[model samples]
Target: MKPLRKIIFPAAGLGTRFLPATKASPKEMLTIVDKPLIQYGVEEAIAAGMGEIIMVTGRGKRAIEDHFDISAELEANLKSAGKSALYKEVSRVARMAEVIYLRQKEALGLGHAVLCARHWVSDEPFGVSLADELIIHEKPAMQQLREVYDQTGCSVIGLIQVPASEVSKYGIVDYTTEEGGLLRLTDMVEKPGMDEAPSDMAMVGRYIFTPRLMQLLKAVQPGKGGEIQLTDAIAVLAKEEPVYGVLLEGQRFDAGNPEGFLLANAVIGLQHAEYGESLRKSLQEYL
Candidate 1:
């Protein structure tokens, strides 16, 4: 298949889970250690060799746009003051990729949010990474998926095995093994109970999808909670084109929930260069 050259990020969620803190800022803008959640995703896409970064953003999400834009005033101030490190950090963001934003006016589901970026991506295959799912692997998650997409010429989604008891929290896929560690998806059940789940393979962030997904999204009538889900759309697409699930070889953190956020913060915080040593020295005390 042709190289997957674009990545679409769906950032239109209200971030109701983070509430008061997110009232002013999008939840994806919440910082992990230093950079915001969305920046981690941007870095992942850049690492995967993506060209255009199209964001399906919503209203009041200007800060997300500003984060990637070249801040001339900020750069000049830093330069005049000899803050080279700070200036370089700010400048690197603008060079990540050609970032283009599309406003998803409604708080529609993930499928609809992705549909908003169709105009920018046209008929090209693209990658999609959730701004909230923080994959903390040394190897960027999207890069891993990109390799599979490049090799297989099939749509791929990152997977992580959740605990049997926690399977109900995500979209679970039932698949038949087609090759080593790769699955040919048979079906998808959203939030199925632990006992009802096909396997512990929970579909998480990071996806490489074809343009056919747009047509599938349009075909699927709204399902759970009256919104279109990307999982459902993909499942339908699987019936035709080949769709595979790659169990992402990494640690992933979901910052959408309080406990997950704290856990993710603690894990990533300990790895920060400025804080690694201190964090390791003191982590046990908190535990």
Candidate 2:
């Protein structure tokens, strides 16, 4: 397993739950503190030594591309207006990596969204991160998985210990073995009920996969909600090669859901400079 040089971000979802805000904007453009959700994922990929980033975007997602590319007018206006901090934020994203954009023509499941990037990923192993699922820590989530892949020469995932009652909300793993904190995966089930779940470990935002996983993705038919399931692809790859999970040493927040989004803002806001004191003080009054 060479370095995880390429990463794929699936950002094609219509974000129906977040509309009418999402009606004009891609949900990935929603900010956590000062940064958009997609930038956070892109930074994680860069931190993990990923060289190429492939974003599978869709309609109304041009803003996603523009957010990362060089913005002449915005940069000029900021410079003239003396908005140094805003300039820094926009400029930083522009230089992150070699970002490639591909449009997913239709709203597909997570697995199908990933398949849209097969050409960009080509024959090499790639990383995957969903912007909706934000993992906050000093180190990025994909960086942890890359370290695991470095040592084991196997596919790695960032796993979290979810409550048994909530196993139905995520893809749970069957823990086969554990060498320290990393668990070797034997099986993966998507959205299993509490009683049916093999383990409490849930697949979160980060993943490192072998090129063979692409083959699995191509072969896997759609499951559950008529969209190809990423879990199903990984399950096939598990039988052919070892796939392991690393318990991410960080907090996980899902921004896709309403409650989770507010929680993310609160959690990140508590630590941010631009809004921390004000946000905390304001929220404290309510509490």
Candidate 3:
């Protein structure tokens, strides 16, 4: 098995939930505390030992590119102002990794976005991270899945046990067996009804997929809303080969929506070293 040195970030969605804010900006560029959501995802991938970033972006997402690029003029200004700390931080972001951009060209779906990266990811197992789903943990969530892929030489997806009432909101996993805390997935169902859900282990957005999955994704037909679904390809992959799901030990925030986005800001804000105490005091006074 090849080392997982590359990861794909699907950032093509229009972010309809954010309304006017997203109307002019990419949702992945929205800040949680001080860092944009996509930066956190990129940092997580780097911490996991992945050095190459393949971003599947679309129109109106130029800010995402600019964020990772070096701003020579801004850096010079910061240096002249004696803001060395801020200057170094900005320079660090530009050198984070070799980020390659690919245009999805359409608001197709997650599968289509991943498919757009096939040329760059050719013949190598790659990781996929949805920036909107932020997973906070001591160990990078992508690294956790990569460890499983290292052991089994198969695909691994991050899982979070959701409540029964929320099973309809995610792709629930059907497993044949559980060993050492990893579920051997037999199949996956997208947003199944309460009674039809196979398990509470909902698939989170982090995934380490074998190159075979790329082929599977190519054959996937468009599902609901005429969009190709990644879950559909994963379901087929489960039947053909071993695919595992590991319950991620972390706090996950679905920053794709307003409620979760606000909660993430508050929760992560309270954990920020520089502003935690002051923010905590302010929250107490406001509440």
Candidate 4:
């Protein structure tokens, strides 16, 4: 298997849920404490050994690109102020990895957004990380999927067990577990009703996909929302070939919504060095 060197992030969502806040800003650029959501995902990809990042972006998302690029004036100002630590921190973001952007002209579904990167990804195995899902773990969650891909030589997805009551909120999968929480998925169901859900293991936002999966994505017809769902393509791929899922060892936050976003901020804020103590104290008063 070719080493997984490329990672694609589908970031073109309109963020209608966030309205005015996201009307002008890409949701991926929303900050969790001090770092943007996309930054966390990009940092996770780099930690997992991926060398290249391909972002599927849309209109009003230019800020995402600028965030990852060098800000020469800001760097110079920091250096002149003798804030070496701050200067290095800001400068390191641009130099983290090779970042490339692709425009998704329309607000198509996730599958279409990912398909936009097919030409750049070519015929190699690649990883996908969704910018809005923040997973906190000892090892990067995408790295866990990479480990499963390396061992099985098949497409692997990050899985997390959700309450059966919540199955309607995510793409559910049916699988048999191998040692170490690895699942051999027999089937996948997208946002099924609670009664129709095949299993409790829901597909999280991390994936390591084969080149053929891209072809499958292209063939997927639009489903419920008149948009092609990635889950539909994955369901087809499972029937045609071996696809596995691994229960990610992490605390995942659905940072795409308001409640989850606040929870994510609290969790990450508690870990922040400079503000952790102050934030914790402030939070305790509210509790």
**What would the TM-scores of all predictions be?**
0.95, 0.95, 0.98, 0.96
Checking candidate 1 for backbone clashes, the offending pairs are: none
Report, for all candidates in order, the number of backbone clashes.
0, 0, 0, 0
Ranking by lDDT: 3, 4, 2, 1
Q: What digit string (tens of lDDT, one per residue) describes model 3 on residues 1-287? A: 78789999999999998998999999999999999999999999999999899999999999999999999999999999999999999999998899999999988889999999999999999999999999999998998988888889999999999999999999899886665766799989988999999988899899999999999999999996799999999999998999998889889999999999999999999999999999999989989
RMSD of each: 1.6, 1.5, 1.0, 1.3
Better of 3 and 4 by TM-score: 3
Alpha-carbon runs more than 4 Å astray in model 3:
none
lDDT of 4: 0.91
Per-residue lDDT of candidate 2, residues 140-200 (tens digit): 7888888889888889988899888899999999976675766899899999988899999
For candidate 1, what is the lDDT? Answer: 0.86
- Candidate 4 residue pairs in clash (backbone atoms < 3 Å): none
Candidates 1 and 4 compared: the better one by lDDT is 4
lDDT of each: 0.86, 0.88, 0.94, 0.91
- lDDT at 218, model 4: 84
TM-score attained by model 4? 0.96
Best by TM-score: 3
Ranking by TM-score: 3, 4, 2, 1
